[model samples]
Target: MSIHLFNKRTALMLTLAATLTACGSDNDDNMTEPPPPQPEPMEYSYDITVVNLTHEQPLSPITAVLHADGKMWDIGMSSSIALEKLAEGGDNTDFISQESVIANASAQGPLMPGLSETLTITTTDELATHLTMVSMLVNTNDAFSGLTNLELSTLDVDATMSWHLAVYDAGTEANTEAMGTIPGPADGGTGYSMIRDDVDRVSMHSGVVSQDDGLMSSVLTQAHRFDNPSIKLTITRTK
Candidate 1:
C-alpha cells in the first residue's frame, strides 16, 4: 500500500477509538450508584418497673402492654374474661394477648411484697400510645392493681412517669377468703371460677377482710390484709 494512504487509514482508526473511549467515559459519568438504601424505621422502646407495696399480698406476674387509645378494663364495667383470669388467678396470658395491644412485656415471675421487677418492651408502631398494666393481689379472692389507658405519646425519650396504683376488685367472685378460694401461698387453693358469684363489674377494692377482722370463715389473716396504693409503677422511654 502507498505510505500516504496507510497514514490516513491509521489516523481514522485512532479517531474512532478515541470517540468510543469518550462515549464510554460519558456513560460512566452519567451512571449513578443506586441511592443508599433507605434506612429502616426508627424503633421506640420503653422500660417498666413495678414494685409490690403490700405487706403480705404477692403481686402476680405483671402484664405490661402498649396499645392504642383503648383500655383493657374500665371501672363500673363488667370484667373481661382476661381481666377475670388475671385478677382471680394471677394469670396474665389472656390479658397480654388482647386485640388492642400493640406490644407487650410480661414479668418473668410474681413480684413479692416489698419486691420489684422491670420489663422492657420495644415497638415501631406509632399508634401504640397508651399503656396498661395489670397484676393481681394473689392473697385475695379477686383483687388486682393496675393503671389502664395511660397516654404515652408525650413521654419523650429518656423521660419517666410514675404512679402509685390503687387496688381494684374484679368482682367476679365473692370475697369469701375460704380454704379453697384464696389462690396465693396462704391457701394454695382455687384460682379462677367461671361462676360470677359477686358483682360482675369492676370497682375499687374494699381491701381484704381477714380472720383478724372477725370473718370467722376467712383463711386470710391480718397479714393478708392490704390497703389502697398497693403497687408503685414507673415507666421510662428509652428510645
Candidate 2:
C-alpha cells in the first residue's frame, strides 16, 4: 500500500472514533436523575362531648385522653394520685400529662348543670387506640364519673359512640358534705386533700345524703344531690 493512502485511511478512522466518543459524552450530560421519594403523612382525630345531667351539681373541667390499650381506673382498685387529684379537687393536669397519653384535650372551665361542652384531640401516633374521659361532680367529696380504656381502633371515620356515665367514689376522701370539705358552689370549700381517709379504693358512689335527707352537718341540700348516669358522654371520630 502507498504511504499517502495509508495515512488518509488512518485519519478517517481517528475522526470516526472521536465523533463516537463525543456523542456518548453528550448523551450522559443530557441525562437526569430521578427525584427522591416522598413520605406519606398520617393523622387521627376525635371529638368528645360531655353533658351534665344533674339538677345543680356543676361538673368540673373535663379531661379527654387518647392512648394505647390500657385502663386508667378499675373498680375495687386503689386510685392513682392523678385520679385522686381529679376526683377530689377537679384537677386534671396530672391525668392529662400521663406518659401513656398520646393526645389530650380539656374544657375551659366547670360545666354547669344541664350544660354541655365539646373538646377535640388529634394525634399522629398509630399506637393510640383507646379513649378515656373524666370529670368530677364538684358538689361532692371525691365523686367522679367517666369511662376508661374504650377501644377506638374499630371506630370508623365520622362514626360515634355514646354512654350514660355513672359516678364513682375515688375513696380518697370522705363525703362529709360539711361546711369546709365540699368543693362545689354549694359550699365553695376545699377540693383535693392527700389524706386517704375513706375506703382507699374506687367503688360505685352511694348517692349523697344531703341536709334535706337528715344529714344535719351536710352543707349540701336536696338540690346538690345526683344519681347514677349523672353525665352523658358522646365520642365521634372526625378524621
Candidate 3:
C-alpha cells in the first residue's frame, strides 16, 4: 500500500513539473521580441554643370533643386516671393528654402559669362525625377535664366542631360536698367525692393536695351545685353 501511494505521489509531482516547464517555455516565447523593421533604400545621384553662355552678363550663383514634377517659376504666373528676391538681388536663400525640394545645391559664387561651374545633388529616391536651376543676369533688372520642370527619369546612370536656358523677366520691376536699380558688378545697385513697379507675371525678357541700345537712362552698357540660351546646364548621374 505504501509503495502504491509513493508511485502515485511521484507521478503527480512529475506531471506538475512538466506543466511548469511548459508554462515557463511559453513565458519565454511571450517575452521574446521580433527584430526591428528596415528602411527602404534610396536611389540615384546627379552632377550638374552650368555654363554661363552670355557674353558679359555675370550670372548669379546658380541654384538647383531636385523634386517631383513642377517648376520653381513659370511664365504668365505670378512669381514666388523667393523668386522675386532671387531675381532682384541674386539671393538664393529663399529660393533654396522653397518647399517641395527633395534635395538641392548651389554654386559657391556667380558663374561669369563664358565660364562654367558644377553643382552636385544626391537622392535616396529615384522617384525624385524633376529638376530646376535658376540664376539671375546680374547686370539687368529682374532677368533670370535656368531650366524648370525638366523630367530626369529618362536619364540613366553616368549619363548626362543638357539645356540652353532662356532669360525670363520676373516682371516684378521694370527693365529700366537704371542706376541704383540694377544689381551685380555692373552697378552693384539695389537688389530687391517692396515696390511692384512692372507687370506682375513672368515673360520672355526683351533682350537688354542697354544705354547703347537706346534706353538712355539705362545704367547698363552694350556689353550687358543678352539673348536666349544664355546658359548651358548639364546634369549627370554619378551614383
TM-score of each: 0.84, 0.84, 0.82
Worst 10 residues of 2 by lDDT: 31-40
lDDT of each: 0.90, 0.91, 0.86
RMSD of each: 10.9, 11.0, 9.9
Colliding residue pairs in candidate 1: none
Write candidate 1's Cα lDDT for 30-131 as tens digits.
654446598788798989999999999989998889998987788899999999989999998888888888899998888999999999999998888898
* Candidate 3 Cα outliers beyond 4 Å, as residue runs: 1-40
lDDT accuracy of residue 175 in candidate 1: 92
Per-residue lDDT over 1-239 for candidate 2, one digit per residue giving the tens place of the 0 to 100 score: 69999999999999987887687778897644435576765788889998999998898898999999989999999999999999998999999998999899999899999899999989988888899999999999989999999999878999998999999999999888899888888888998888889999999999899999999999989998788899999999999
For model 2, the superposed segments whose C-alpha errors exceed 4 Å read 1-38
As a TM-score, model 3 comes out at: 0.82
Find the number of clashing residue pairs for candidate 1.
0
Per-residue alpha-carbon lDDT of candidate 3 for residues 23-67, written as tens digits (9 for 90 to 100)? 877879564343558876866778999899899999999998888
What lDDT is obtained when candidate 1 is compared to the true structure?
0.90
Error of 2 at 204 (Å): 0.6
Residue 178 in model 1: lDDT: 92
